[model samples]
Target: MTFDRRQIVAGLAGLPLAAGSASAQSGWQARFPELVMAVVPAENASGLTGRMEPFCAYLGRELGVKVTLRIANDYAAVIEGHRAGNIHIGFHGPSSYVRARTVTNGGVEPFVTTINSDGSTGYYSVLYTRADNPAASIQDLRGKNLCLVDPNSTSGNNVPRFAMSRMGIANPDQHFARVVYAGSHENAITAVLQGTCDGAFNWWNSEQDSNFSRMVNKGMVKPEDFKIIFKSDLIAGSPYAWLTALPADAKAAILKAFIEAPQKDKAAFERLSDGKDRGFHPVTHKDYETIVELQKFVDQMRRARS
Candidate 1:
């Protein structure tokens, strides 16, 4: 995946950068000369590079600095960038956020999350198979090959695995005939449809938007061609987070920009989200404690294998 700074038209007014409170008044400009932002490679780079340029320009104009966008090759690169203090702001899935937060020794804190069309801050991890398959649930997937997204994916891996654990099928390697990482949500669904795997994992908003829906919308797949085998409870959406080491004033401006970007520029916001999301809502580290706990559970299961 090629990560490059995109050239986008500028001069859009960002939502108010500062509030009336005294705390909001700081030399934010002097503190932040150049801002570097990264997004985990959740989709193809070309699409993101085209869609995100306006958002970056909005950030640049509001923060009184130059914003350089970096699309990472994979989740690990984004997490590593955050840990090394190279990325000032990042977009990360819940599972990757937890891992980055832990690996960075709590140096990353979430400030905002995507607000879905249903006004929820979460989505669901789902399993799908060919319509001809007799699988009614994940339990039926035993002895069948499975396609999973990356290990750091939330709905793609963490929540779905947890659901399996609750169903008394905690050990996927032992249950499935074989498990393969399809590298992305779209790929996972495609793998199942193409017969590369009998089952696949993906995620989407509870209100009718997901990887499957995206594919269907693009004419890549049809609704009647697949069956949902399992769906996990609401998993938190990805977040706009910044390294905790960043100065509070700058972080405040970044959060403010994120919170208001959708309302400020609907087209840019919609393009950036790539979903039926309304906007961003405030979130904190405490908000992600559930994900932290989930990661802990996943870790123990992996440790048991070692």
Candidate 2:
């Protein structure tokens, strides 16, 4: 668990300092002058660096502080960076955020999330079947082949499982003729389209930049190619969180920068918000209570199974 100080310092050097700032000011001096934010790759990509460059630049310029983007290969690495205090801020899924908060003992707090075009702060977990599938509802899917995203995914796995459980479908293996883990939302969608699975579960929101739309447009599956049989209640979207150890001034500056970012740099905001359909909005730890509860239930179930 030992990190090289030189390497950490080198990473921080890439961060931009606030305008006219002589020295970095924060309650906890950054191991380096720049703040490092970590994000999980969506489809085995190395990181979000390539996707979020504009957003990172906007943050640096607006906050008068250096902001650096770090990509983790998966969700667990994102959590680990937050726990180790290497990541000053991060964009994390609800379940991963809850786990990170627990590990840090309140050291992290969500500050902002994607705000949909309709001004909604939440999204849905959609259970979809092929266009011509006879299944009209969760109950009707019994004995059919099913595809699910990763075990750790929120809308992809957790919410869908919760929905099925509530509907009295206790075991998918018994209900579905077969069940397959597709690893990613896109994979699940593709499985259903290719006739590999009768149904698939994934997240759907107004945020347009997501790969979901890409797959749809690529003819992997048309909008009309599937039917949504179940949709979960709107759950809080993922947030950009900061470590509690950050200085009050630095934290305030960063929060203000994020809130005003859309106004100051509309293009950048749109890019980070996942396309022109949404922008960032203030969020807090309490916003994800429902997700936390869901994670607790999932964990309990996992332990019981083990």
Candidate 3:
């Protein structure tokens, strides 16, 4: 888990600094002396910070500025940070990025999104229950407790609701005996494993790339202890976005660093990607249009509840 800082620095020396020219580095740095990158709490704060620090350090060296990492308390905090112009870059789930765009009025733009190790750019929302729970499907869990990761979580909340609605369970709150927001993906999975909830919705990319897989790798949960009872259609992978207001040169520099990470900063990329992603692919708002529509649907559901 150690990154070769000297190797990374040496490799980055040949890459374009800013706007494809070394001279523009000072111009972009003058505008953004320090860049703050914020992320949602997909895992515990300490673990997330440890995983992100190397990537942040690599980005800082490539950009010639201090790149600070902030593990947001929740998805809303990341969105709010972008809205307030405090977060220069945000790593967000698809639905959270949609919300960030809405709140900022297109102020944030997605520069790159994850590419799965299988070469796909999407993942699934899965409804998981204890393997011995006898619930073969989401329908079998009627009148049972359900755990959602967070309101802004795509796989944990929005896509689950969308999949459930298609299954005729129009109102999850009413359909389930009780519903709870676990606030983060790890927490939601933990609730289900602890029997605090009968089931939880979380993201799964493949057999090797998933929240469950990561936990299993950490020995936090056994793979055989839980089963996915339901799975949603492919949802776009999470994105790394930045403020559109930043200088064009800065945006180019940031995007360049990410696009080159897999080659120039292999260890950081592996740690950040959990060895389950191929690399970052250039992306735009158009790539997330379907998610934008889905978030709007979830927003309407929220308004009705209020």
Q: Which candidate has the top score in TM-score?
A: 3
lDDT per residue (tens digit) for residues 1-306 in model 2: 112334433454444332123475543334335678777544433224545778888888866556777765456666767766777887877877888898889988998887777777777888888879988897898888988876667877788888888888877778889988786677788788888999888777743534466566445557777778877888778788888777777788788888887789888776654454556788888888988899998887777667
Clashing pairs in 1: none
Q: TM-score of every model?
A: 0.88, 0.82, 0.91
The order of the candidates by TM-score, greatest first, is 3, 1, 2
lDDT, ranked from best to worst = 3, 1, 2
Model 1 Cα lDDT, one tens digit per residue, 1-306: 444222111111121222123333347655556677788766667656876888899888878787888776667777877766667788889999999899999998889998888787888887889999998988887899998888888888888788888999878999999999887777788788889999998876753577677678668899999988777878877888888877777888888888788777777788775648888889988888899999999899889888
Enumerate residue pairs that collide in model 2.
16-66, 18-64, 18-65, 27-247
Query: Candidate 1 at residue 255, lDDT?
Result: 82
lDDT of 3 by residue, 128-217 (tens): 899899999888999999999988999999999888888898899888999999988889899988999999999999878888898998
- For TM-score, candidate 2 versus 3, the one ahead is 3
Better of 1 and 2 by lDDT: 1
Worst 10 residues of 1 by lDDT: 6-15
Error of 3 at 115 (Å): 1.3
Model 2's alpha-carbon lDDT is 0.73
lDDT score of residue 147 within candidate 1: 89
Task: Give the alpha-carbon lDDT of every model.
Answer: 0.78, 0.73, 0.85
